[model samples]
Target: MPHVEKAVKDWQQQFAGLKTSAANLMQIAFPPLEIMQSPTGCCETRLHWQDQDSEASGYVCIDDFVQATLQFENVPHSVAGQALDEVFGLGWFNGAELGVRQAGEGVYYWTDETNAAEWEVSVLPGGLANLSIEYTNAPDIATLLDALHTAYEDPHEDDAAT
Candidate 1:
């Protein structure tokens, strides 16, 4: 009816849609299938995860958070350090209060998932980034580090499902 009302309605609908998506993902992740969505949302629409290739790491999850199988491989930790620095500086973590840690001389890690947008991600290390992040505290410190360590340890066996 009014401009302000229309904007509010639109925003509400968008939030509702996100909720529905989260519910759907929860159903798939923890219920009849227990499979997760790829960063691409490929298996999510089908209610099952596609067969994962060996590229880095693996993951297990619930609606709230994910647990990664940390075993990284074939990573140029030195190079990745710079790459990740650039990544963290771009998004919410850019000026956020959350802390980013250096796992080693060339490896970095951030345990904060506070600013992850639903269905937002560009790259996944150890399949640790969520495709649809609904909870601010998803993948707490230990779990995130596990995945990071795993992915870096055996980068070939990891997949993007977190």
Candidate 2:
């Protein structure tokens, strides 16, 4: 287990920028997503919510800031793929499926220009394996915003510039 905070502050901090970025990039307008605490030791310490429209949603279950289990959905395969990077700090390469370089036996990875983050993957036979890399260490992010910025050139576009 890496580490993950059982809090929603991260989402709160990025929601506005995420919303704007999604709008600019995806061209699909969605109101703010109110990430709600899904209080549970009974289930999992997590935060959950649905995006304002599109039934698309994401949830982060960070029992103790040790690590997180994240998931989101959208109609498009590409858009859905983008979520792992945008909604979660995990997509360093932004386009790994386009191509991935072998890192080791049965393993491949994609890295951002700064090497700040990477999507370490185990392309197991039929995609079944348990190779894990701590994707939560990312912050300045090709891992953070690339998915949301997939369509926009200026991924780091300041909200004030809008």
Top-TM-score candidate index = 2
Per-residue lDDT over 103-135 for candidate 2, one digit per residue giving the tens place of the 0 to 100 score: 112444455444333444443332122222332
Misplaced by over 4 Å in model 2 are: 1-33, 41-45, 81-135, 138-142, 149-162
lDDT by candidate, in order shown? 0.34, 0.36
Cα deviation of 124, candidate 1, in Å: 30
Q: What is the TM-score of each candidate against the true structure?
A: 0.25, 0.34
Worst lDDT 10-window in candidate 1: 99-108
Candidate 1 local lDDT, 91-159, one digit each (tens): 333332221222322222234444542222223344232222223422332233334344444453232
Top lDDT hit = 2
Looking at candidate 2, the ten consecutive residues that score lowest on lDDT are: 153-162
